[model samples]
Target: MARIEKFEDLKVWQLSREICRDIWHLFEMTPLGRDFELRNQMNRSSGSIMDNISEGFERNGTREFIQFLSISKGSCGELRSQLYRALDRKHISQEQFDMIVVKTDSESKLIGSFMSYLNSANYKGSKFTKPTSTSNHADAQNPEPETQNPEL
Candidate 1:
């Protein structure tokens, strides 16, 4: 709500960071963590949640930030799914699964709340205005216009 200066200022991101740490700790204890395929997938999904939130905040306007928040939320879901896999595979106890699930759900609710705040404050059409220049390069293709080619 207040002008966020650092990524830590965001409660959702802080929660995500904590979740990542818990996931890493779980990875160290679970047998699935020893398997390269499962380990890599779980770690990546866990890290993505925090990474996306920070990336979104660094993207400058509220619109870009909200989009990034959505991505972060998706990553959280992915992380949760992987956690479930670990549980179903008998790599973790039900207690462990429940603990992580609670954290993931809390993080999701926080992200949603942040998105709502941003939407109410910046979704009035005044916030999506693009810089009145060629700053669209990120989405634009090559500068040279393509000519027709009929010969195959």
Candidate 2:
């Protein structure tokens, strides 16, 4: 598999971002927006899913990343519960509830699969890898190569 250099490249993170936007837009069109408590909670939970994924990726450790992914998965469950509450309160239609639930459920599965991969993978993280070349040290000491022009 190709290297994932950034969180944006992650499929799970991308999906989470899409879900967050969907929730934000859905809430904006409904009276649930007036319910400050539920609105804020729902927004936070959705955002947390994306945030945790990005934060975990940036941690530079497979173990840490897995832990963060676990947290993100929990946030997915929280969002699902909030969807039920929204449906119960008639703040959202049955269709919207089903749609959101499906998205969250899919995200949770993705996160779980990723965690499983991390657990079995031998590549720990970049932070744990040692530099393979001394070229960096030599360049830092000399600051210039003899083959290059002295003046720019």
Candidate 3:
């Protein structure tokens, strides 16, 4: 498997980013923009999905990453709930609601699958491993190696 050096390399993070962008577009183009409370909540929840994933991945531990992924998945559900409110308020079209819902559902599933994989994998993440020492102490000066898990 190719090493996942950063959260941006993960497919789930990329999908979350796309969902964030789409939510922002809805705010800009729909009546949802004028509904300050719902708009802000939607914005935060959508952004949380991506932000949590990155935050967890940067924690450098499989356990912490999984925790963050769980948060991101919850944010997906929160955003979906907000979307329903927007739909009920006539702030968004049914078509728009359907599209975003599909994306959020997919993101939630992807994060759940990732967490399951991490739970079962032999790799315990970079933070669990000790840096190898050499005569020159190069490993000590260099940053810890990136996690070896494949991006998903």
Candidate 4:
């Protein structure tokens, strides 16, 4: 498997970003914009999905990354709930709600799968790894003898 150098390379994060963009579009085009409370909550939850993923990746630890990914997954669920509320309130069409919900669900599942893989993997993380150089170890083990001074 190729190394993931950044969170942006993550498929889950990419999908979360797309979902956030879709939610923003709904705000611009739908009555949901005027409903400030729901709109703000929705915005925050959607943003959290991607933000947490990036934050976790930057932490450079497998445990911390998994924690943040779990949070991001929860945010996905929150967004889905908010979508249903928006649908009930007539703030969004059924089609819009369905589409966004599907995306959020998929994002949640992807996060879960990633967390499972991390849990099962042997590699802890980059931060936990130590540098290994045979030459450095040998130098450390045997130092050069000091020269004697004749006129002390």
| lDDT tens digits, residue span 1-152, model 3 | 56566778889999999999999999899999999999999999999999999999888787898999999999999999999999999999999999999999999998998999889877666667666676756544444444444548
> Best-fitting candidate, measured by TM-score?
3
> By the lDDT metric, which is better: model 1 or model 3?
3
lDDT of 4 by residue, 1-152 (tens): 34455677677788999999999999999999999999999999999999999998888787998999999999999999999999999999999998999999989988898888778766566667565566686533333222121110
What is the C-alpha local distance difference test score of each model? 0.73, 0.83, 0.88, 0.84
lDDT of 2: 0.83
Candidate 2's TM-score: 0.86
TM-score (C-alpha, index-matched) for candidate 4: 0.86
Clashing pairs in 1: none
Kindly give the stretch of ten consecutive residues in candidate 4 with the minimal lDDT sum.
143-152
Candidate ranking under lDDT, highest first, comes to 3, 4, 2, 1
Tens digits of per-residue lDDT, candidate 2, 6-125, equal 788788998999999989987899877877899999999999999999999888788999999999999999999998898899998998888889989999998998888778777677
| Best candidate (score: lDDT) | 3
Separate clash counts for every candidate: 0, 0, 0, 0
- Rank the models by TM-score, top first: 3, 2, 4, 1
Q: What is every candidate's alpha-carbon RMSD to the true fold?
A: 12.8, 9.6, 2.7, 13.7
- What is the TM-score of candidate 1? 0.77
TM-score, every prediction: 0.77, 0.86, 0.89, 0.86
Among residues 3 or more apart in sequence or in different chains, the pairs in candidate 2 whose N, CA or C atoms overlap within 3 Å are none
